[model samples]
Target: MANYLLKRGNLWWVQRKFPVDVKDQLGTFFRKSLSTEDADAARLAVPQRMREFDALIGQVRMARDEGDLFANADEQPALDQMLVRYQGQVLSGLSNAAQRRHLRVLEAFGAFVGLNLTAQQLASRAKPVVEQWLLPSFGHTDAGRRALNVLIAFYDWVVECGYAQPPNAFSGYRIRPIKSVVVSRKAWTDNECELVLTSLLAEAERPANVLARDNAWRLAWVVLLGLSSGDTLHFVCEAQRQTHFKALSADWHKTRACWPEIDPYWVPGLSPGGPDGRRSWQLQKALGRRLTSLPGSLTYTGLRHAAANQVRPDFDAWLARLQAIDLSPAQA
Candidate 1:
């Protein structure tokens, strides 16, 4: 057997063999606890540890054969090559925007440790590169955690591709939670929603700049939709125009105000500019000013949550009717 799996106390111990030639430089066998007592759990964990051990053995064998593994490989591979392959094959399922974000994470890591460096060069010094450069660059935030996650995937891919070895240096790292940045989300109150609607409705009626009217009209729609439907801001903004939940064709392009026949008022893509595209920030600021009780950073998401709460009385009434129906049948 290349490695041994033994149970010591309640934990499963994975003992990997060290190369006899480099036994003095390394050791006889490297042992680590798999930290599980269950045999099935230990069996599931063995493949990963085995892959890691096999990679370590390859490194030792390579070093013994050629002075260094890096020296033995053909023209040093570019980091971008692996990234391209990874994106095309592994990340093909992701949306364009999601794929771009993952690429940015990879790019950030590349920047952390010069883009020109190969996977082998990176894997060799993973610990220092992560601790000194990667972690520090990201700080202790959600973005940092995302960066680490991407790096772990990248390293794992490299290992699978035979460009790097096992025991992926960046694997098993957890992001340290930073409590200061956490914010508790709260829904908007009825009074607050009313204030927003009143302010925007007045602005929509304003006979001044056509642009201002357009902006107000868009915000009013968003606010009303969010307050009633509980749709997400992204959905509120990007969802195609629909008449009674049925999608509108591209040829049906006309502002909801102009297309009363199409019944576009209740649809998402209502505005001539198409759902407050460029002016969304301005609209957000305007709504923020009206609802002074909430932070200016508040968006339609909070508004929608509050709007959902507005339906509670209706929901309760419906529930009561359902119970009444059951009781009537029983009483008769």
Candidate 2:
């Protein structure tokens, strides 16, 4: 039915000329055989062929819009030489870490453009290529802004050193700020808590790696301390023996909040002071990584909230009852 459909002897075919704008990239005409002499069958296939033609045109147009439809040939030594000069001139005094960070961004751009362009050619393509790169690569996050900032600085140096002309391509481009989402720290449900604990205990028994086994065993005890006595990961990590109370205790370093006394649960091959005297936050990260493989979104901090939710209306009575329970190291 479409004008693009035609008959070549016995076999039917579809053909259409590409739009003038995209003709160079996509060629003059798109032609394909329908592989059928039956007119009714060809008619039914026409719609699908037309859809394919539309899709090809759409892709070429999008690439053109992004200024990447044409492939540019490699220009020798210009971009690399300029980057070398930039390091010596602008980045000389910066720390090694800062220098590496800036250079990494420039190298990424070089890689994106196939390492094939003069400074002038790169500058000309910078605007569209950067806009395309930023949206899909980093979106509106701070990392995107940081990368843009790095490029803007690089281009400013390029212009200043006469590698490219005035009007910096990367200058004045700002990714829209990301909208802040307030995450609610809701407590895990009873069944969810039970599931996570069961999974962690099971992992502790037969983890494929030593690190996984150690983290799983420690996390099981950590979750139990939080669920039983509202003990935070930090408190549990830094807990010390209290001779008078005949149990372990720790004070919250930030708020100076005292934790309810509870007996220590030790796992084999792990110290309460952490591996090689690692800090509480370090241990929390190790344990958190282990939790990620389990079902549901569970957090170390959320366990404290779960404990608060469970022991409502009578805190002292709940603590007393929890302390009365005979918890052995093997139970963990």
Candidate 3:
């Protein structure tokens, strides 16, 4: 049995008996029997809690000399070390996936900021330091959101698992980030596009500035096909009209405006410009013959821009193009 002493302000003192070695039960009994709405409770509770505190101090000194049962490898029974032991015992035995989240949060932030803090020290906690100071800037990004989610899930788990005797420090927290959209992406220049178009056309067209009517129309056809295939551009050209979702698929009605389940159809010896060699290449070749044109190569990406950019401008059009194919704008 241990006797607790009480005090009033800095002067009066009283004593009583408390019978436990546990920490919380003593603190609770100390707070309740001593604290009051009126001066009388403070007067009554102080001396009693102080007496209990003295008993606990004596018990601590005795235990420190008794044995190493409560000691760790370092032989220190500090609160930090003690909490770790409690965590290993209680947190390890708990099978709850959700509750483990809080333990993770405690492991992350509790060591430096939360645990072993004075009541005055809590006013300078780290959670708000990150949320109010750091997260305000980065919280909008994917990395920011992920970090906040990890901490929150852990905090929720901790409280749910009864790791704390009361509410956890993480509750009522919000992690909203600022919203902003990216408006631009890289696209090939018209001169660069002209070169790429040449590569996609017939072998005879590679060095020839003067393209036949069929080649010009073929290039135009291919360019339009690639561009409108993106989300931003909804319109389709003549060749694409047949395979375009509106004309080809019954599912387009149900799939909203999205790409749905379309797969790429790769074929050799075909330019995106047009399979039909029917028009306008003759005029291009004559123009090229009239004045030698600087040549450009048509790559897969270049052909895509040539086909699409005719309808939409660079950024939104590129974005739309990516969206139509179900690719992310971030990739663009």
Query: Which digits, one per residue and each the tens of the lDDT, describe model 1 over residues 246-329?
Result: 543222233333422333334322434335454244445655565564443455556766766773223232222222221111
Candidate 3 residue-wise lDDT, 196-218, digit = tens: 33433333233233233333333
Cα deviation of 219, candidate 1, in Å:
27
Candidate maximizing lDDT: 2
- What's the distance in Å from true for residue 270, model 3? 6.9
Q: Per-model C-alpha lDDT, please? A: 0.60, 0.64, 0.41
lDDT, model 3: 0.41
Estimate the TM-score of every prediction.
0.34, 0.44, 0.29
Ranked candidates, highest TM-score first: 2, 1, 3
CA RMSD of all predictions: 19.6, 19.9, 22.3
TM-score of candidate 3 relative to the true fold? 0.29
Sorted on lDDT, highest at the top, how do the candidates line up? 2, 1, 3
lDDT of 2: 0.64
